[model samples]
Target chain A: MLGPGDDAAVLRAPDGRVVVTTDLLLEGRHFRRDWSSAYDIGRKAAAQNLADVAAMGADPTALVVGLGLPADLPAEWLDGLTDGFGDECALVGASVAGGDITRSEQIVLGVTALGDLGGRAPVTRSGARPGDVVAIAGRLGYAAAGLALLLAGRTGEAFQELTDAHRRPRPPYACGPGAAVLGATAMADVSDGLVQDLGHIAAAGGVRVEVDPDALEVPAELTAAAAELGEDPLRWVLTGGEDHALVASYPAGVRLPPEWRVIGRVTDGEGVQVTGRVEARGGWDHFRD
Target chain B: MLGPGDDAAVLRAPDGRVVVTTDLLLEGRHFRRDWSSAYDIGRKAAAQNLADVAAMGADPTALVVGLGLPADLPAEWLDGLTDGFGDECALVGASVAGGDITRSEQIVLGVTALGDLGGRAPVTRSGARPGDVVAIAGRLGYAAAGLALLLAGRTGEAFQELTDAHRRPRPPYACGPGAAVLGATAMADVSDGLVQDLGHIAAAGGVRVEVDPDALEVPAELTAAAAELGEDPLRWVLTGGEDHALVASYPAGVRLPPEWRVIGRVTDGEGVQVTGRVEARGGWDHFRD
Candidate 1:
């Protein structure tokens, strides 16, 4: 409603800088109709991109979407998709601006998110100095646990929690701007699990991150679900992805955001470790094959 | 190479504003491998999106691409695609700052373009006034002519000109920023043919546009190709699309750029007409079903 009719939507950037990020979600690849509803897919897609903006320690401001749908798709499907996008944007006080529509064999949604930096330098992944405290602002293993439940042919009320997490990831969007205000040094979103994403910060900052298993604050439900499935809960927290939690490192004695909890520390080493020991594996790698 | 290893790329917007636009190109729907090489398809896709930035009367600054390719796709194909994108961006002094890559069953390219306002008011399509001189920059009907030549199975040097135009459109990119500085009232890019694209401006501005057929500078090859195919060259120029040319209207006596040619004038009426008569048809339309 706030001047979305213009050529480009106007957004306020108190720090005189904006962070922009985009992602493409292709049907049958990123999501499946059998697993994700039209509405759920829309919210998940928008959330993932918005989470990227938040990972930069910026407040989400606006989003522009380009959707390609097949000709046979029902009009109601598009309406539901738009409704989902609007619902998610409304949560952060952002608007869904103009978008282009074209015909394709499969549904493709391209989302671009705009963010405002609120009077703080962007907390990038390249500032994790040695001895910095690495903290997280949200869950780590829920989405992957949800995926496990779905794969196990589980349904009904007993599996609803896992299903909901996979359908719509509730990333810690507000904590990103809050962490930036609190003076976090380096940060990234936990989209590709804790270990893989932290490895990005580690490589960029030229330091190793030592995560402590005993210091983790994982939810009770994830632990129960992993126990039921005869799996390691720590593996779920370390390797499961798509939670989009904000993870950052701060200099010693720097005040941390209320939602953030210390889980690790930066050290003068080559890679990431768990409790002073390096893990042999990590999360998703797009190009390793 | 300038600070490209980050979660988000920074672009300078000296005027405190930017013109942003996006589009998606899906394989088998937007382009065919048999007709266009990977490089040509990439160039065409970039040209189409860059034309949108030009339509807003802004100079293109940077592009962020989201590429989805199948796992089996050769690395060389990606190389060709990136080379084409780099070539086009280099022409406008722009760069591909950052992008996301994901695996998919088919090729899908989601392109977002950012631009600088250059301290000039953006030329939108809602400001055309009666008596404004409507003009166009760049070639018209060439791409359509090329498609026609190929469809009719015209081969060898006889149809080479038409074939080339369809493969890659050479838009007048600088004319967009130029028209903005010259006080053009309203503007759009001619991607959906002259008459069809102009119809958008006419409908949006609530004015009629009268095109002079004799004033048109049709290419000699288009006329010759039309004769060989037994089609109307005038119709091709009026209805052929995908040239990505900039079209705008100026106040009377306003000096126009060298590349721009006066084609028509705005009138106090509805719809667009050719010379003194209204045409019954034009170019591509979605939802025709």
Candidate 2:
């Protein structure tokens, strides 16, 4: 219920712990003004940070935003950005509790999302164990496919959905808490591609993550766009990022939520393998990519 | 005990509520590479935001940072920035809880500080009443004077303190909770100049704030700098910002903490007045100044 208009805002942490995460989205590196409206950028920024909170199996509670704007930016764009933040926060019953604005040469957004654990222990990536089942609970390559379509100038009506996914990822916010309730051992958000993110889990858990590529149900939307672009849809699923999917490891025999589909498993070893093939370093590396 | 390397960080909010605030600092606008070391920028950034948390009468707990850097930025600079953040947070018994890194056209920092109120009510700006004594904790014009010395290229060892103040502000972190314990009715940090920030408290509290210039004991350093620059030290004390001093209103007869010095009083009016003169407009306005 706390709002802006003060030096700082107060949020109730009934569980005695707060979940916090931050993300920075720069104008050219994260999004292009030509490709995304201010509203799209704002929503994407909020979603990415909120997804991080969700990945911790916490209930999103509030967000503090730090925005940098060029003086030449239009007032309407700022208004639209505020609305986008409001709408995205509304999705998880959170509010823009406080924010700071500053002048910058280009648009930059720094968002910190706070969450409540509701008395549950946080599920961390380091908790995965051998023989655990790996599952995912959201779209995988749609955003990447959308980006491909936009870059290829394939903006037909049939490809509008793909482009929209790229502009504003619809993360399955409930899946995080659901997985935690269902006894997930470890979890992470697939913001940096499935294979790459799972690699983090594998590295932390000291186990090998082996994905059966055939188990992945490539959505028709991604496949059609891949076909149009003469690209392999499997690569998008394996290496493309920004999808904001929820991936987790659960012990065998635990009843999995219907939304979570088995795609891989944890085994004795190290690193990530897709169908027994070690994937080359891929996904988003801010400096290198 | 929780730190980085996770999707999100968990902070113990033992008071059952957390106070949060965020600030964005852009290169060339908030700090200059030529004038400030990366460590200086980092410490200043942390100080400003942590001061905001303190202004709310909370004990600083943790900070989440979002950093954007050009690809060519040296690793040593990044390390220095990290050390600066860690050192500043250590000042308030806090930690750098989590952070994100990204590439941008220029360096930018988005910092969010969280605090625990320790069961004390937040001293917001809206609680001042007529006849309340207005007091300040910490320096007033030192930072402004430092900025002046730097701008004038007065690099003599005599002016090094002022220049250092400009590069990094030292806020009175404990004064906030002390003021709250002393029954402060309203409070704010003087980040946007004393007069400008006092206006915020006056407007929020629906009372007039009147300051006596004679009551302010201008530091000799600021006075000397003003003499050398042919400027009025009072102007820097009144309208120059970024000092980050804590100003609060306390009911008449309430004993103030030793750190707080009475410099004014609340009266029946609508805004801030310095020695019977109403400031037309002063302080930093991001879009305009």
**Counted clashes in each candidate structure:** 0, 0
Off by over 4 Å in 2: A276-289, B277-289
lDDT of 2 at A191: 87
Q: Note each model's CA RMSD in angstroms.
A: 2.9, 2.5
Candidate 1 local lDDT, residue B182: 88
Error of 1 at A5 (Å): 7.6
Model 2 C-alpha lDDT per residue in residues A61-169, reported as the tens digit of each score? 9999999998999999999899899899999998899898988888888999999999999989899999999999999888999999989888889989989999999
| TM-score of model 2 (CA atoms) | 0.97
Q: Which candidate should be chosen as best, given lDDT against the real structure?
A: 2
TM-score of each: 0.94, 0.97
Best by TM-score: 2
Across B8-43, the per-residue lDDT of candidate 2 in tens digits comes to 999999999999999998888899999999899889
Error (Å) of candidate 2 at residue B235 is 0.8
- Native contacts retained by candidate 2: 0.92
